[model samples]
Target: MKLLVLMSLVYLLGSTEALKVLVLFPYAVKSLSILGTGAVRHLLNAGHEVTYITVYPLKDPPTKNFRQIDISKNAELFKNDDSLTIGYVLEHQVQRTDPLQIQLVTQESARLTFENENVKKLIEDPNEHFDVVIVDLVETETFAGLAVLYDCPMIWLYSMGAHWQPLRLIDRATNPAYDPDYLSPAKNPLSFLERVDELWTRIKWQYRKTFIIQPEERKIYEDTFGPLLEKRGRTLPDYEEVIFNASLIFGNEHDAVRDRPSTPQNFKFIGGLHVEEPVKPLPKEFQDLIDNSKHGVIYFSMGSFLQSNSLPKPLVAELLRMFGGLKQTVIWKFETDLPDVPKNVHIVHWAPQQSILAHPNVRTFITHGGLLSSIEAVHFGMPIIGVPVFFDQFTNIKKAVENGYALTVPLSHNLPKDLKAAIDVMLKDDTYRKKAKELSSIYHDRLTKPGVKFTHWVEHVVRTRGARHLRSPAWRVPLYQRLYLDLIALVLASVYLFFYIVSRLFKKTPKKTDKKKRN
Candidate 1:
């Protein structure tokens, strides 16, 4: 009985050391932010105290205890700062090391820095301290120096698919190339020019970081953390040393995307970190429609940003014509009333996307290949016809093609008959459906749920003092050094020169001597 009581006491003591985490998202929280909501939900459920920071102030925010950082109040720091274009912001900020400009840069930086300070105050004022800081990749870069200021291990959580910009920046290494389809790995591969285009993108990001991003980042660190670290007799850790929570990238991708040579240790693909949440059932009418539709339904949505209402008339007319021709009942997530609606088509201003995807009668999804949409498609085993627009959407859809689950058509003023042909092939072909189900099987058959894996990893960071063991050491090698082909080229060149010289010296001169005698 005494032993049992001692064990119980030990368990209680162990449970009391839950991680105190700081999560930062520099952008507004969106319904589709899997990383933001997934991490927050997992941490909360795991009994971790999370101080989630965002730039936007909320009127009636989450009842759960979260520290929201509002940056709207300090918009004046960007005053007359026209030179710092988003494209060139990082570079200009880095080059202008003048105290005055650096001061202004630091002031802007302080707003984000202050948010971390606020979190620190919350902990320290109550005689508490965070075990770790887990930030979205974009947010992590903004207040990068703050990780040092707080003297805590940091985790960089990338919320999206393997975008070239983040991958190269984080690993400082390049891969062959990635398809836009997000799922397909082999087909519709990037051409040499396309691969060079990807390289160019990295150059832009590098320029932004070195010239603009790093300078501003440095200013913020110098102002907020420099003196603080000096007092403690310490310096900042190199960015590569920071543990990155990219494990999702490895998990959510289909075999087509992952089968390629992905550098291990640095870019951990731990995707599907979000799972379906319990929510109210869809309206009875919608459920009834799903029940009645014997012919599989086709779901059409343009995603969050580009509203259906904003679509050009030509595109709308083209879509309506295509839908009118379809035998399947078309469910369009349209925001406004359409002038011409086919009898077979149903228009609902807002559709429960996940709910719709979950339905068995739902056959095909036509989407913009947003990460969330693509993940949902994979989750539901629904083949998609992606019409990608911007950012990673192109690559996501390309990957889908590579994976053999989707077809893609560019959004343009004048689309050719090939667009219709592609759609017709997708509709008639059974291969897309079979491959999609295979991927879904893999997505669901993982050892652990995405949310659980994410939470466990986050906790691991706290437990292991930043999970530095997981970091990729490849970031240290310079690009030229990593290629090593340059060294081989030099070796080959030296051999060629040595052979050429020896051959010239040993060459018989009898032909030239005879010709001179004849002359």
Candidate 2:
């Protein structure tokens, strides 16, 4: 293929220096696939060997340079682990932001993963070695134990959308005052009441994380990975020590779409790293469908975890009717086939999402506001109608709406009506399309591709022997020291001491006689 030949040329001309890289992501869906592919592609192009462990196995043949370890059971966990369906989400929407949910999921997943036979075998092998470890740091930090086992530079690859979750590892977490939390309905530069809610939300989250989840996490971690650590002739590392010792933290964020936070040198934003050059070719039927639509095509997907067929039948029927009346053709990634789909609407079990977005005829995108999908929509100059589901999806939609390229319709009882209204506005407005084009320009205006940046940082971490100089000193500093609370206490104590000494001296010096006159 043309793409293969081009990549071969890049490999021949590019850096011949190689690394032995280990990527461990035991629980994920398309996130693991997308990120793992990106890391492997750039590393292989640079002539490195990658050992990737994942639930999703690579379909392509492994060359001498690229190898993979399959833990495909995680795929089932990711799919069936939907405790947060639409109705459930609507009912417990307020509690959905609880950090406990993320912690528990991560803890159990980590247990299932680290204890897997494949992972255990790899850990037990004394001859196995790697120069660097790249870990997917979403919903779990327990895998940092691998950093201990491998005794190599570890890079925390954070793919989740904007949140303090991964930031807590290498740097101080975001300030709740200005940095709106994913759980709270707030943005930066907030009002007094919003700030109160933000602070409270952060407090409850930290309280639960510290008191409830962390204890359980430590127990699970010790039980699952203690033997592996002992086998390596190392003691089990404290959770914070293991997670915080990362040489680099690669964040899947762009400042254009996220509220800027003060970040250390090691925390780099490589948001769209997986979007490849020459873009993957669209399937023939999809190419024809878009090419044939004179009114332009609209694309919709709820990401990998949630399926459209999971929706109530009546709601699905109503949405179909609305799509039936649309001028532009609709390409919906419906999970199951339906007999009564409208002529203008095309439904398929799977979609070539990125390729379809890149098409010239894509007029709009309806999404669940997943970060990758949002970024792709911006990349292809397609505006959005975001129906946020969970996690940072709401924040992604908030940014898109703020950036003037999208509108949001929260999932609720009236989702059909609300979605239709939002869709109508998207079709009527040229401003949204103009804004999308502008953002696409801004997003692409970077100096280098995200994939290259990721590769460079990974190599840097390995070359510098964990890149320790780049880590923030703040990670080691205690909260009281960081806040200068101890200094304040010392100052207050000194002032009181000074007053006490002065008063005692005055009394002891027979001030009663002269002090009465002095008083």
Candidate 3:
């Protein structure tokens, strides 16, 4: 009888502590989905019941607590989309600062996610319930409706560094005077013109988001989630309210590698959480190649999204010619084979990037400036030469340059020469390596591993029932009040009224004097 009571008590406690978490990362970008995967894995390992909605599902067999809703079909949209390729972007001179194009693209992706048969089935299931909903912090605002439907706390996962878009959702907007927009090419300590440009860029984005993007997203939100709400006899809340009601935001950022902004309590930085520890060993061939390098090795990759084969033929030839002349071994992540390859250069269709970076013989990394790559380079104490393609890549590289561990070479006719020059500097300069190591030390100096911290906060939010106390008061404050625009208008109006009164008094005094002279 005593044994039966003890066993029952243990089972009840375990059941009470295990939360049902729904993680939605329906974005087709593999790089972005990796962050979501890291968070989900941690949740699963923590004994939580997780139902992950992903474009890339885990290859391993599922456990009892883990359920995957694969939406890999959505990734087909990007597989053949040349416009998203770096070559197309460079050739067409796409203005990444303009949010219209990307906003539309992400909205389309959200629509696809909502329409996914698996996602729909999950939504329609009457018995489905979640204690918390974790979602990607891109333009997937419509997915926030799930939290509303399930009546669970929503946690946003940001795959990039802290930016105004996600920040404004949980806290106040960042100052544009010094903090450049994520998509803007401008760097900090901006010149007068740069400041004006930054301010205008933000204003334009906000205007477009308010007048254009929001309405479209609202419609999509309603169209997708309306029936579910109707079935429950509940009307949908305002789109903005639903999206902004997130309990917390976990940003892939660290002060050691990137600038730390004034973030609220609800905002947490868990950069490098995706970097698996005890990195897998390199293949024997790669290991031997790195170990036998005379001078050192330069590892070059354009990340998962951009393909090296997409580069213009002339540029590819130029890169090859540059690599041939270099004394250091060059390992390039190229998608397709090239003719007349250099003996010193090695090409791999796919690479174990972290393993390669962890090798001591790797002197420098030539990269696409993706946040993950940048953070990984910092993690392994490798200096970088960034060739930023678009979007936040530019910002990530700019921050690295400002931090003294990296240099940027723009994509153009002079890229080969400029890249060679930067490579030469990175190889010869001990200062860059020293700075990288220093940043690495700081990055590793955290009290807890990022994954542990991430899981703890997530469980904390669940335990505390959304941890509402950590939410910023700024979310409750009106936009006009937050900006103090009303106060400024009141002061300006008072000054204008005072000046008008004085002008009238002077005119009346002059009229009286003229009348007295006539008398």
Candidate 4:
């Protein structure tokens, strides 16, 4: 029996072919990209083969099994659009009409057309098969039809923190589009007006999906693969079902200050999976300064896309002035030189963020509340002052403040005073430091590392043949059902009718009416 079992195990291991995964990561500035690299690393480590499609050079080279599909050299439609570039959009898309997401959708659709044409040309030789396609959630709807055309399993990865909009869409729930500001948990959950706003967002997205994304996608498919497939007399799969990739992997931790009612079975929380080893060497000057400064160091970075140089001069000048007055040595991550020099302040074009955050003398981080930076700070157990610029940064910073690890200051023309006030508050409060350390401990006290959890899920899906059992039924149910609206309305109507009947019975109506009729 032992010999037979060993033989069976070997057979199973040997028979399992490397899962051929087509990874779509058509984003720019790949160096700072978290989701693409994270997904690639985990998939490759698990013995799955990956074909990465992207517009930028892969920042960290992949393992042996990984292959590259170079869309980086192609620059016809998306070359000029800054917002279409992934790194710029993340830090800059504050307004809903901010052209980046729109341009992303436009370029993604076009790229899908190109990719499909390429695939069709290659498949004529008859040696291509893909087991699965994993795409970032943003443009999955555009190119996902190709996955269906190839008859492959599809998984959508949420590259950022979770929110109701994406979660609802993933599950096929009633899509209530909520604006970023109104969706905050800091306020009451959802007011009536806010609920209306959400409804409008849902309506708009649905319109765009049906009218905009679908027809454009259909035309592309019809043009490229359309003729070849027509020769075989087969129509492509419906774009909606093809576009909606069911499973999701979120780059967020459950313990983080996120508003999650329950974990969706199909959704995996692998927040810190993309964390990288410190690659860049620390500057000698910065190292010497750190060694010399007996007082603690304060590190400030606004992330990659948003230039500190672009910040209104008044605010910049004021910030420089304040930092110069401070006793502690300050390291500011800036793109260019400042006109005024503060003796205490040091500016570097790029700072080794993880290394500095890891430093023993680093007391606090002043940041833009980007998730990666916030996660690092939490990992290091350092206190923070968050000055959020846009998008989910506001929510992230707010959550951090609520969780007791940080103070938040709004970004505006008059930022220096607010920034100084926030800094002073964090510096003075020992409790913030204590809380940060405690939360950091909680963040780390997991059954395994986040990447391990991520890997397990990826393998689990492939092994289980797409793990359809794990998908949430919540998406299948309507919003009204989920909200229990029918039940509430029934209860209210019953109470109202009961009160009306009781009031009628109590009135002295019959006797007087009968006497008047007789007269």
Candidate 5:
């Protein structure tokens, strides 16, 4: 099998010598924990020594081969609130994303985490060295300090899709008209109004980012790392310098999922790294339930970040009642128990999602439209009914609906009825499953899986100092040259002068002609 061969390659190639690698990702989200591990696991398995910094590492045992520095305090960014529910997520992450509080939280979280004692101890050590550094590329660029301090090449591992900001770090951003903002509700082939909205909003967003955000972020970088850099006789390299030098930007997106033209050479998609070919098996008890399903099985979950228990009690009860009445056996991942559940309905605090989806009897997935969930659904050749809540969920569900393999119900509508109706449509129509299989074939058609691509690429960046050829020339171009603003201004001025001179000549000659005619 290709996976076996890939593992052999890693073993043979990795055993030659050990590489020292440092990976930095301090975000508290559980999904990010998985992503960071995906990037470094190959290196760890291949006999390399790794120093990892993260918020919540899924693996706890420390080995001489691997050292982990926990910065779990970043979890404070998501405050505990009794009122936090799906509706709350819909309001902020979906309706609009530019809340000032969110901005402040991310900026401050990055500053605090990067300045933590554990982080400082590692960076300040005179003996500590690494061949390469990898940092999570989020809204904050200050974490690039690890690369600067170590005097090594950096690979930015972006956990989600490529957005305008990160894309701009590599090359000129894709045209907003065609690509749109990552959060935009509109797809490509926009109406006139949509085009105007995208262009105008993009222009304003850029202006604000350039004038306001970059300066503030730069200040934070200097304020936090100034002392550390000063010791090495170096000031903080500007944000542009930090990101533009990346060997490659690992995007958690699939080529088949995107409709755009060729992207920058440095932008590589390695999505589905989390999916397993032979998915992990479910527990015996859960397996029996799936095997005994008379009709079929519908799997439902809201992912790690959102809790199904957070929904209003009445709504939750109603959904439960409806599912109990249905012929299909229902598997709902709920954090708490219900008093009187139907015999056909099973509830659990945690469910093995991939194994469930892989089972032949499992029919469809109900999800919050998170990128990772959507990707897994497509990978398993299973259709989905998306309950879109927030952030990129809007975009993910829209694509699913457009692809004809899924339907969506917004949280703003009647949650129980909408969800029920969407499920019925998926179960009744064989077309959804057929289309899903088509998409799955496209997703699996790649020469190698995402995991292999990641292992090879990570090693490649380590062996070569950034593989600089991968970087685009646009990275080095000055603003005026790239836009040709000065050249356009000069041409406009020349045209104006020519017209003025011609008009003056005509006026003077016309007066003479009029006088001659009068005589």
Candidate 6:
């Protein structure tokens, strides 16, 4: 009888711990979607039932508790927009350093996601309920409508290092003085001009968000979620307030990769959550190439979004010429076949990037400096030569350069010479290699794997019913108070009043001040 009672208790505890999670990652970007899927997979591993809304679906065998709502049709929106492509940006000489531009794109993506037939059905169904909602935090405020509809705690999964935008929602915004904007190329310990530029960039972004993006997002939010709230006899909350209602933020950052910034208890760092553990062995072809390399090997890739085939012919020729002279074998991730390839250079249409980086025979990485690529390089103890294209790529590269394990070559007229120089320096110098190894050691020294930590915190939030106690008090403070602007204004007013009193008293005794002149 006692044994039966114990078994029954265990079953009850297990059943109670299992949560119903709703994950919405409607963005079409593969890299961004990967982060969301990582969290979803972890949640599933922890025995939670997940309803995943994504443009990319996991290929794993179907699980009993996992249900995916495909929004792959959203990818068509990106297919029609070429402005974000590296080829278009390069040919048009477009600078994608504006945060507002990226936000605008995200806003549009959120609108389309709501309009998705499956997504509309899910939100419209009153039966659709979840214990918690996890959404991608890439300027995706409109998705918060689901959280409101379900009346569940929302968690933001930030795909990059701590940025001011998302931080402001959960806690105080990071200072622009030391922390550069993610879109800016400026590094930490910023120069005077860089600080000025950073502040101006932030101001512009805030202005645009308040005036342009938020208004449009509010309309979309009300149109989608307003009816649901009305049916429940609940009035819609302020859009700004709804977006700020998240209980926790999971940022993809690690102190080993970047300097640790001040974060609230509610904000968790779970960088490298997507990195596979005990990395899979390389395919035989790649293994043989790495093993047979005479001196060493250099791996080159422009990430998923930027295709190497889009590079100009002259630049391609220049890269080929440079690779031909090098004793080190070059493995380039190109999308299409190129004519007159060098004997030393091998081209693969697709690459197992992490697998290649893990190889000891690979010396240096030539990359477009996406955050994931940079973190992978540091994780594998491999030095990199960054050729940043757009968005946070420049900032990621700048951070890498400052960290001593990477060098950057601009995509300009001097790119050929600069690329060759960077590669040669990275190959010949052992300092870069040493620094990379040091960082890798730090990255691997964590007590718990990022995936496990991510799962624990997420479960903690659900178990604690939003963990509201972990939230920062700064969120309750007004912006003016947080900035100490109100204090500054009071002090200024006091000084002005003191001066005014002193001036009036002096005027009453004015005759004494000019005594010498009167005599």
In terms of lDDT, which candidate is strongest? 3
Q: Give Cα distance to truth, residue 486, candidate 6, Å.
A: 5.9
Q: State which candidate, 1 or 2, has the greater TM-score.
A: 2
TM-score of each: 0.72, 0.90, 0.90, 0.78, 0.90, 0.90
Q: Give model 6's clash tally.
A: 0
Residue-level lDDT tens digits of model 6 in 364-432: 999998878888898899999998889888878887888899998877756778888888888889999
lDDT of 1 by residue, 199-251 (tens): 56545545655666566555554555555566667775554343233321233
What does candidate 2 score on TM? Answer: 0.90
> Candidate 5 overall Cα lDDT vs. reference?
0.79
Q: lDDT for model 3, on a 0 to 1 scale?
A: 0.87
List the lowest-lDDT window of 10 residues for candidate 2: 510-519
Backbone clashes under 3 angstroms, per model: 35, 0, 0, 0, 1, 0
Candidates, ranked, lDDT: 3, 6, 2, 5, 4, 1
The C-alpha local distance difference test score for the whole of candidate 4 amounts to 0.67
Expressed as tens digits, the lDDT of each residue in 460-515 for candidate 2 is 88878889889888888899999999999999999999999999887755335544
Off by over 4 Å in 2: 1-16, 76-82, 87-95, 161-163, 508-519
The residue-level lDDT of candidate 6 at 173 comes to: 86
Cα lDDT tens digits for candidate 3, 245-333: 89999999986854556889999999988898879999999999999999999999999888888888998899899999999999999
Assess each prediction's global lDDT (C-alpha) against the native: 0.63, 0.80, 0.87, 0.67, 0.79, 0.85
Off by over 4 Å in 4: 1-17, 29-32, 73-126, 172-193, 207-214, 217-234, 277-286, 474-519
